[model samples]
Target: MYLIEYLKSADSLTIQLSLTLLFVVVYIIVTKLTDRIIRRFGRKNEIALPRVVYTIKYFRFVLLVFILLLLGITWDISFEGLSVYFLSFFTVAGVGLFASWSILSNVTSAIILFFYFPYRIGDRIRIVDGDNSIEGIVFDLNMFSIVIKNEHGQKVTYPNNVALQKAIIMLK
Candidate 1:
């Protein structure tokens, strides 16, 4: 009832909706163009398609955020108010990060692993730290850790941050 009353009085809502639809159409067009460019370049060089697709998706997400911000402004949402909201959000995020330092470290390491790709599935790896060593075949690479299968057929999981920090010997 309140939403209907607000919409009925606001001519800006129609303008916001039109702008949002236009943004979506333009976004689709731009994405299609990007896909063609990626395909053309990727075909010439043997670039991985999944990585290219992920990059495109990230770009699209940023573009969508910008479009949404524009829509909000068109609807007369106050930028000053948004700044306070974002500041509060960042403060909360910072507190959460401080509370979960180990988890954050693991996530950072996983992101690095994704780009560096020191080890892949089926590769034999030995992780050494001081006197301890774990040897196994790489099974999977997840967001927080790496999974492996040892000679005894036991599954082992190592947090990415710790695993990447130590000496890793790739046998294959």
Candidate 2:
């Protein structure tokens, strides 16, 4: 057919190289734009924009991978081949993500808590969830846990994720 003839006659290598170069240029421009935007907005706000920065970085990485795949396709690489390549990579990434889901979730919650100012160190806080109750002064806030010292002088450590989920009452 005419389509087959056109495909065979097309300069696939040239197309691939051009696309690769274009992708690189676009990526650089996007990164600069994102940095400028984040700086402009984030500076005006009281809280630091770690999540936004992380999201932009992740997006850039994904875009770079997409561009590379496009380059391969333009050079007459088959979709089946690409799928096989990405499948293994995705499988490994998925397993790692699954294994670390709890940690990641807790870290994300901690980031939100940091910006929200729900409770701070040295603040008296009462956490009541069903029959479990702990009234204490927050001593430390770390990545994994929040350390609190109760009236009985007992140091209690609650996982960050668990602390975020419960209702916290601040007392003067």
Candidate 3:
């Protein structure tokens, strides 16, 4: 049969190599599609928000990790080996990133706010924080903080971490 002939034409290693290459190609196509989806999302929101950029980068990183795991599987690597490798890597990274955990928290909040934040640029809003609450029109938002133009025309940069903790009232 033609199928039997084709299978006999290549060694097992060669067939596996071909399949691995195909997997990489598919991974690349999926990564590009995610990028396009992120772009379209940003455009639809009418702002190429900083969180969108971060999301795309994070999405690619996660996908790369997945494909690398698949590659390891293709090469007959054990799951336990992969788990040990990732665990050790993240452990070292965690030690180094400990001091800057607050920064990391803010970045995480920014990602959440990107999808669910009720206010947009030019929207007047108030943050409830006891007597010291601030009211302003959102001017800009970046990974770390959000800039707001206050009643006195002062541009206030509020940390994203705190933004999530407070109650936000959108004003007309």
Candidate 4:
């Protein structure tokens, strides 16, 4: 048949289109599976709504990065060419924003807190910092820091890194 002959002679655009569809299918399946796992784990652990939402967002961001990398490879984008572009951009970013590496550390801390942390929101906790100890109710936690409301009704923003490093006493 003419249709069979045409199919046997797939063009470059046809090949690219097929590959794109394959990648999209894989991405969707992986994303859905990961999302279900996160939600199930969150429910089992009784994680707060805000915490669960943020965790999902973080995971989706990672998946997006992976998909973009795959897209580049599928399109035959030159990594050698990209290396030159990224090298200069990263060099400048590294010099100007080197001090902000703590932000990444905080993000790592946030992930740790999301899973292994013992306390939940609304639990009263005291961080032992010698005489300058902080006693407050756990308020909110995000990508950067954990918020706490002290007894005097003041909100304290504690860096996630410090929160992880210090000793905490659960008051409630």
lDDT string, candidate 1, 1-172, tens digits: 9867866787876757867788779878987887687667545554445544544565577778887887777778888978998999989998998898778788667656655665677789999977767899988776678888999999998888998778899885
Return the top candidate by TM-score. 4
Using lDDT, rank the candidates from best to worst. Answer: 4, 3, 1, 2
Tell me, by lDDT, which candidate is best: 4
RMSD score of candidate 2 (Å): 6.6
Summarize candidate 3's per-residue lDDT along 1-172 as a digit string, tens digits: 9857877898879877977998899888999999899888777887655668887887888899888878887888887867898899989889878967878888888878776777788999998989978899999887888899999999998889999999989988
| Residue 43 lDDT, candidate 4, scale 0-100 | 90
CA error at residue 28 for candidate 2, angstroms:
1.0
lDDT for each residue of candidate 4 in 1-172, tens digit (9 for 90 to 100): 9756865798867867777888889888988998898888889988887777778888888988888898888788999999999999999888766868878788889888988888888899998988878899989877788889998999999888888999999995
Q: What are the lDDT figures for the candidates, one per model?
A: 0.76, 0.73, 0.85, 0.86
| lDDT accuracy of residue 71 in candidate 3 | 85
Q: Of the pair 1 and 2, which is ahead by lDDT?
A: 1
- For model 1, how many clashes? 0
Query: Which portions of model 4 miss their true places by more than 4 Å?
Result: 1-15
Once fitted onto the true fold, the runs of candidate 1 whose alpha carbons sit more than 4 angstroms away are: 1-26, 29-76, 102-105
For candidate 1, give the lDDT of residue 144: 74
Which pairs of residues collide in model 2? none
Please provide TM-scores, in order, for all candidate models, with all chains considered together.
0.58, 0.52, 0.75, 0.83
Q: lDDT score of model 2?
A: 0.73
**lDDT by residue for model 2 over 1-172, one digit each (tens)?**
9856765776867556766787789878977886677556545543345544654565576677877777666667787867987899989988997987777777666655654645667789998877888899988776566789999999998777888788889999
